[model samples]
Target: MDAQTGSTASAFPPGFPWGGAIAANHAEGAYLTDGKRLDISDGFPRGIKHEYDAVIDPKKCYPTHEAIDFYHRYPEDLALMREMNFRAFRTSINWSRIFPNGDDDEPNEVGLQFYDSLFDEMRSRGMEPVVTLSHYETPIHLVG
Candidate 1:
């Protein structure tokens, strides 16, 4: 183990992959752009620890509203991840982005395109994407 980093050199076997993960609601920030609509995460002004507002209070600031701007800056961000030698990335698919109403008969095409591009970007950078169908951010329309 290295004294400074406290990490053993070659701790795992050869070909071991290293990567990072992120939740869609915590990264994607195009909130209502395109055909997307509000989801459960839209009301958490102070994260999951605090009580979510009964409705979206425009007065309160929500971090997920613009979290990292990853939705738009993913190319640059994925490049940075490649620079760090990340071989895999785990991320969720924002359910509401695809089915804005949760029960919609057809999916939103633009949303599908966004993810297709995102996954293609990762593959282009030699990063394998591990995708989750959904995270905690359910479409608000379903709750109504």
Candidate 2:
């Protein structure tokens, strides 16, 4: 066991959660482009964390707006993750992506299609995809 990094390889029996993670806001960047609305994370200038109602820094670049372009690059990324022995991939499905503004007349089919394809790819590689409901990305309209 390494004292510095706490590498506990021999401690686990089997089925440990070896996973990669991504927030919907930080990874799925089709933001408001495909019928998506403004999620709270859309206003978060800091990619990691910020106030619940933080005002976005207009001058600063918004990383979440692009967010590695996961919406379009999941296939290549997931293949890399499989190569890394990632047994599970964890990612939040952006609520706004599906519902537009949290409370919509109906769910967005395009958003649902994206997740379906993503999970299918994961399953094909024998990887489990853990979905988070809200990863600090509730639609901006819902906070009030």
Strongest candidate by lDDT: 1
Question: Whole-model Cα lDDT per candidate?
Answer: 0.90, 0.83
* lDDT for 103 (candidate 2): 86
TM-score, candidate number 2: 0.82
TM-score versus the correct structure, for each prediction: 0.90, 0.82
Quote the lDDT for 104 in model 1. Answer: 97
Residue range 21-131, candidate 1, lDDT tens digits: 999999999899889898998778954576787577887888878888899999999999999999999999999999999999999999999999999999999999999
Best prediction by TM-score: 1
lDDT of 2 by residue, 29-85 (tens): 877677888887787665445443356666766667888899999999999999999
Residue 84 lDDT, candidate 2, scale 0-100 = 95
Tell me the spans in candidate 1 whose CA falls farther than 4 Å from its real position: 1-10
